[model samples]
Target: MLGRTMYALISLSDLENDFINPYDLTTRLNRFVAVEYGAQFVLTAALLFTGKWFLGVAQLLLTAFLLHSWSVRQHVVDATDVFRQLPLQKKRRLIMFGAFLFCFVMVTYRLIESIIHGLLTDEGRETAKKLFQDAAASLHHY
Candidate 1:
């Protein structure tokens, strides 16, 4: 369902650009950006929900970077201004970005810690067992 929604969102962008009168460049760009945002947001959430946390976070980073780069290249609007123009209220924007940053930091820290333990520690096996018990439980008995 999430994947379908994402696909639909992406497709909507193409449809809007092609059929919404190509002469209306600003409208096309706005519609594309909004749909792309929704698609990326859905993909990120889907990846995280399916236990692909790293990929999910990477998708989010890609989304941000893509929007910034696209805005710069297209000269449609400043990337910072795009964010500022979100329909969200000030407090909501703060909380939303804050939560995203917190998750990114924690996930990155845990991944680095795991890597360091695997490479440099004698207790790597035990640490892995303890830290990934929930993940392990999802595996098949075979």
Candidate 2:
């Protein structure tokens, strides 16, 4: 699932050129902003719900700035242009590798966190369970 999400992010990046019709600048900008902002917002909300409030707010602010910053946007566009110059097969391979790396890192991170929690928080077991329940309930906003 994480790999799929990473693939979507890579494929939907503004750097990916049209194998079909050309997209206008406005359309490209809108799509990029929507995807970047939407993903960041969801990530921020998830982090906050899972009890990482500071990290969530910091990420939210940073991503908000990235969304608004013309320089950052142009930098991404430039990076994507470079990526677009790659051969199709190479591009596919790179994206797949990226997805795998992301998935592995995320899974490992979560596993480590779970292990640490298990070792350190025996008294908070019930609290953790309630927190997860609340987090799941919050997802109904979708």
Candidate 3:
């Protein structure tokens, strides 16, 4: 979605060549950002409700990063005359990128933790064996 916007901004031209219309651009950006926020907010809440605290907090960090990035984008675009915060805006984008990477790490950590937890203990070994048997049975059906 962000790529589409950038492509449009580059390929399309306005009188001033900054944007077709600042307000219209702002509105479109706001709509997508708001929808993304709404979806993630629901996901975070659902995760917490399901007692997935670690995952919920990780998801929350991603959500906050996206929301903050959107706000910075709006601020950059909503400037009346000339927005001279290019460096600061770049920093915000960097932070957003970092947030995505960190979220990836968090998920990987959780996956490894679960796999380890499911491997060491006796009960976990039985559970894992059961899972494999069930999975094999299901595969045989196919």
Highest lDDT model number: 3
The RMSD (Cα, Å) of candidate 3 is: 9.2
Give the alpha carbon lDDT tens digit for every residue of 1-142 in model 1. 2333343334334444464333343353454555656766787789779997766776677567556656666324333353443232223334334545655686689889878766856576777677689677767564
Model 2: per-residue lDDT, tens digit, 1-142? 3444354444545334544222442244344545655665687688779987656666556555545553544313333354553344234435435544654576589789888686766668777778889999999999
Q: Rate the local accuracy (lDDT) of all candidates.
A: 0.53, 0.53, 0.59
lDDT of 2 at 125: 73
> What's the lDDT for residue 107 in model 3?
71
Error of 3 at 105 (Å): 1.3
**Model 1 lDDT vs. the true structure?**
0.53
Worst 10 residues of 1 by lDDT: 84-93
lDDT of 2: 0.53
* Candidate 3 wrong stretches, greater than 4 Å: 1-31, 61-76, 79-85, 116-142
Could you give the candidate ranking by TM-score, starting with the highest? 3, 2, 1
How does residue 87 of candidate 3 score in lDDT? 44
- Arrange candidates, best lDDT first: 3, 1, 2
